[model samples]
Target chain A: MANFLVWVVWLGAAFACLVSALAVVSFRNPFYSALALIGNLASLAVLFLLLSGEFVAAGQVLVYGGAVMVMFLFVIAYLGDKSEESPWSGGPSWQIVGAVLAGGAILAEVIVVVGLKAGDFLSSPKPVTRDFGSPAALGRLFLTDHLLAFEVTSIVLLVAAVGGVVLGAHARQGEDPTEVHART
Target chain B: MRGPDIQWYVILSAILFSVGALGVMLRRSPLIILLSVEIMLNAANLLLIAFSRLHGREDGQIFAISVMAVAASEVVVGLGMIVAMGRRHVDLDVDKLRTLRG
Candidate 1:
């Protein structure tokens, strides 16, 4: 039964991911692309949870799929209206060919790198069933061992937040108000 | 791992990552490109946690968490910048982005 659940989770996550990817590519509308990205992120979060990585999964859903995606959609709604030109007119033919070739090369390289070694990067950590969100575990690991890295991440987020404000504000200042702004 | 023996999870991740990369290459909208980048990062994160589980390691989970945190910061700033640029140009198309292009 447990095994069945795991497989089910895996299947569902993969399907969601595939759909989201297609949506990302298929949609010409930037808003729809943003929405698809949200779906993709949510599915990936579910994949994380299925693998028993609960904290990361929760963060994936909350921080990324939730907050960041909404931020992106806001941008889309703001900018996409004025240009009525489809962003999906597609790229130059040569560029598409180049992209395909480059993607293939990267895929081949990754296949070489990640090759035949499921055993290398994994070991059975205490399963989520045994303990979920034990603040003590997070605290101990975070404070003593991972504190420096954690501090760096805080700095990064601070930068991102401040940068967002400064940059977003600058754009508002730059818009040529005489022409059409994003139509509602 | 033999090509066939590679767990479905690993294969799926690689596929997703490639799709994300392709999307980045093909999409004209900055927002779409950003989404593609996020897809690539999530693929990496998925692989990280999967490895942690297969090996019974907490370190992998911890690392994954750190990556997630950093990813959040990236989105906040990165999207802000993209949107800023979008607003200014009123054009997020990749072609117009050649301002920096040599």
Candidate 2:
């Protein structure tokens, strides 16, 4: 019974993900694309929950859906939301042909790679532990096995923060601050 | 409800990644390209978590967390660049930003 519910929820989440992802690539207005991607991210979080990745799901929601989406929205709103339809939408035939060929090639490669020996991974020999993807388990790995990488990630985040502020300041230095808002 | 086959997740991840790659290649807006990259990153992270569950190990999930952190930083830096670009009144068509077109 529980498995049935998981299946149903997974189906709904996957459908939502597919629709929103398609919308992300197809929408002419970038604001719409940003909104669609947020929906996609939220659906992915649900899938993570289905996989028992509680910590990962929370992180996805907090980081991607909350922080990242907010930044995208901020940029869109500040930049003045205009419908800038992609040039690729009505370009010469060769452009579409090339893009389609390239995209198709990538899709074929991914399908081939993922399809190989895929069944073997699903049939696990033992049951996963209740705490397998719990915060405690992930934290243990973070501190012990993956300690170096874990700490390095923190350093990277710090550097990125400083870099962002510096970049923003540099941009602010040349332009009249009032003009930025006025244009919007 | 008998738990999904691991292959199903792999297929979904592959599809998402492919779509994201297409988005990045075809989109003109820098912001949209960044969004595409985020989609690609999430696809990879989902695959990692799925494989972790399949293999009964915490390694993949830990790596996913690391990926999340990297993603957060990436968006910060990318958006900073976008904000900078906006200040210059550079038309958001990224193809025009080429200074070394040799």
Best by lDDT: 2
- Candidate 1 per-residue C-alpha lDDT over A1-184 given as tens digits, one digit per residue, 9 for 90 to 100: 6666667777887989988987786577768877887888888888776666677777778888777777777766777574233644656989888887888887777776666544534222334434433345655777878888778878877887888778767534554743543552
Model 2 DockQ reads 0.56
Model 1 segments more than 4 A misplaced: A82-90, A112-115, A118-129, A132-135, A171-184, B1-6
Models 1 onward score TM values of 0.82, 0.89
In candidate 2, what are the lDDT values of residues A1-184, reduced to their tens digit? 8888888888899889988988898887889999999999999999998888899999999988888898888888888744255646544567557767787887788788767765665555246877878989888888999999999999999999998998887544555654555533
lDDT of 2 at A14: 89
lDDT of 2 at B68: 89
Supply candidate 1's per-residue lDDT for B67.
81
Best candidate per TM-score, number? 2
Q: What TM-score does the first chain of candidate 2 have?
A: 0.82
- Candidate 2 chain B, run of 10 with poorest lDDT: B93-102
Predictions in order: lDDT: 0.70, 0.82
Chain A (alone) TM-scores for all candidate structures: 0.77, 0.82
Distance (Å) between predicted and true CA of B82, model 1? Answer: 2.8
